[model samples]
Target chain A: MKVAITSTGNNLESKLDLRFGRCGYFIIYDTETKGMEFIPNPNKDATEGAGPASVQLVASKGAKKVVSGEFGFKVKSIFDSLQIQLIVLKDNEKKISDIIELLNHENLN
Target chain B: MFTIFVLNICSLFMSPRPSRLRKISNPPVISGFRPYGNKNIKGKVEAVFLHFEEYEALRLCDYEMLNHHQASVLMNVSRPTLTRIYARARQKIAEALVKGSQISIEGGKIYFDSEWFLCSSCGCYFNNPEKQVEIKECPLCKSTSFSVYAENNNNEEEEEEEEEEE
Candidate 1:
């Protein structure tokens, strides 16, 4: 399954599969297949409504799961509409790579 | 090609003569992807408080190279306020560069200017306001500047004579 990680800089993955239009980049990883693609977020100039833009960008990447730090209500609604799995950071301290490792472990079990 | 051309045409209509000024406001926002395989779990996120308005001011007056008076008018702030903003901005930016802190683009008592400027010299562009003071020097080059594709009309006679000679 292709999983998309929402990140800020090099750490902090999205806990839920949500992005504000303001985020800079996304990393797409294939859990079963071990493929990865880095995508720059497309909504650099969006003045408002970041939730829709984030969802559209992720959907374009054909990702099934999303991990991020926080998910706004508007973003949560869009992910619900799109049926994208959303996970937020539990302790708000886990690094993005650690989250990816956890996801890989989940897939194996 | 069509889109770029259309954007250029639109830009021409937007600001025929860009002023050499900057504003004081929130800092530039930065967002980007993580490098692959950065698994280190412990790093403190640091923030530098330059404010977006401060950045706007510097961009207009310093980078865009507008005089203080012109930049103040573009930002819709009084000249004195702009001067203060610019000074503070410079100090903070200098500090940030020296100290290495994350610059945050939040919380400022500033508003966006309605007008924007395009540089005639290097094609570097900025957004500012109309009714600004007349600017003489190019912000980037410090030379007397003109608008892109703008003809001085007075130079036309000289050009005609040169053409005739040729």
Candidate 2:
């Protein structure tokens, strides 16, 4: 299974981005292969419909679960329809590395 | 006055639009009920399709012990509409009981309200996007200390007051 986490930077040490649609980067982490790929958000500066666009980007990566600080109202229904699990972490100080570790722990359990 | 009267007459001839979709705070746990042990000879047992909105109306009015006006506000519909829904729900239930028919709860012009949760460990608010799965721990820190966030009734009251002022 693969999980996507919104991040403030392209590196694992970057903090978790608080906003989902306008996040700086999206980290796609594969559980089985333990591989990570960072995709810069193209919709970061978009004035409208950023949430749905970001959802499309993440969906294209085949992410089963998404971790973010918050999700927009428009994206919630779309995600629900897609049957993609959403995990909200409120801690803005949380790093990408810590989130990946938590995902790893969850997979092990 | 003559133009206004003509406009009113024309409006009366037009068909009324459908009611707005009711907002359901929570989906029912079970799909519906079934009648059993019927000795009467029957070719087929008729099934009553109870809409989700009607089920919600029944729940709010009967199970929750709320008045029609209060339930209407909660459901985001007018009081008359809520009463109509409640009446329909009761009638369907009664029909199902008397006729030994199955009651299936599905299909309605309703939207499910998302529930918000507050994580004490991380001090963040989040909502459960998926309704099927139960949330056990905080998604960020994996902390179990959390609480279900309740809608603030005071906010609605304040909004009403502001509208009154306007």
Candidate 3:
């Protein structure tokens, strides 16, 4: 399964972005193949409807789960309908690499 | 004057529309029920559709044993509306029992309430967006020791007060 984690920077060393919609980058990590891709958030500077647009970007990548610090009010129902699981990690200091490690542990279980 | 009189007559004949959607704190664990051992019945029994709101009403009132006013407050609906839903739930249950029809619980003008959990190891709060799957561990740290987070109600009340002040 592919997991999408919002990040503050392009590299895995950066902390997890608290805001899902305006996150600087999205890290797509595939568990089976262990491939990672970083896509710059196109809606990072969007004034309106950034949440749903970001959702579309992640959905298009076929990520089954989304890890972010927070999701907007409008994005929950959309994700619920799409059957994409949302994982809200409230720790602002958690890095992308730590989250990826957790995901790997989850896959092993 | 004549057009106004006709409009008043039309309004009187029209049915009252339903109120806003009710908030359901918990979704039903099972989808529905099935009837059996009815030799007198033929093939393909008719099924009664029960709304999720009705199931919640029944649960809050009958199972949880809360009063109408309290249940309505939890559901975010009026007492009378809750009583009406409860009544419908009973009536549907009775109809299904008598006719041996399957009861299928699905579809309603309702919004689900997400529950938050606190990870003791990570000291982080996260909400379970998917209700169908059981959360076994913390999403971040994979910790087994966690508790259900319940501070959101106070936060909501505070936000409401802030809105009122603004």
Give the per-residue lDDT digits (tens) of candidate 3, residues B8-120.
99899987776777878877879899987889998887899999999999999999999999999999999999999999999999999999999999888886664677778
Query: How would the docking of model 2 be graded?
Result: incorrect
Q: What is the TM-score of each candidate against the true structure?
A: 0.35, 0.53, 0.57
User: Cα miss at B28, model 3 (Å)?
Assistant: 16
Error of 2 at A108 (Å): 4.5
**Candidate ordering by DockQ (highest first):** 3, 2, 1
lDDT by residue (tens digit), candidate 1, A10-53: 33443322344566668787877877776767675678876677
Candidate 1 C-alpha lDDT tens digits along B20-121: 344333335452112233345347535567666677888788788999898888777778978898899888766665555556655565533322234454
- Reference-based lDDT, residue B163, model 1: 96
Over A7-38, each residue of candidate 2 has an lDDT whose tens digit, in order, gives 99999899999899999999999988999999
Q: Candidate 2 has which clashing residue pairs, if any?
A: none
List residue ranges in candidate 3 displaced over 4 A.
Answer: B1-65, B68-113, B151-166
lDDT of 3: 0.87
For model 3, state the Cα shift of residue B72 in Å: 8.2
Q: In order, what is each prediction's RMSD in angstroms?
A: 23.4, 10.7, 9.9
Model 1 chain A poorest 10 in a row by lDDT: A10-19
| Native-interface RMSD of candidate 2 | 3.4
Flag the better candidate by TM-score, 1 or 2. Answer: 2
Residue A15 displacement (Å), model 2:
1.3
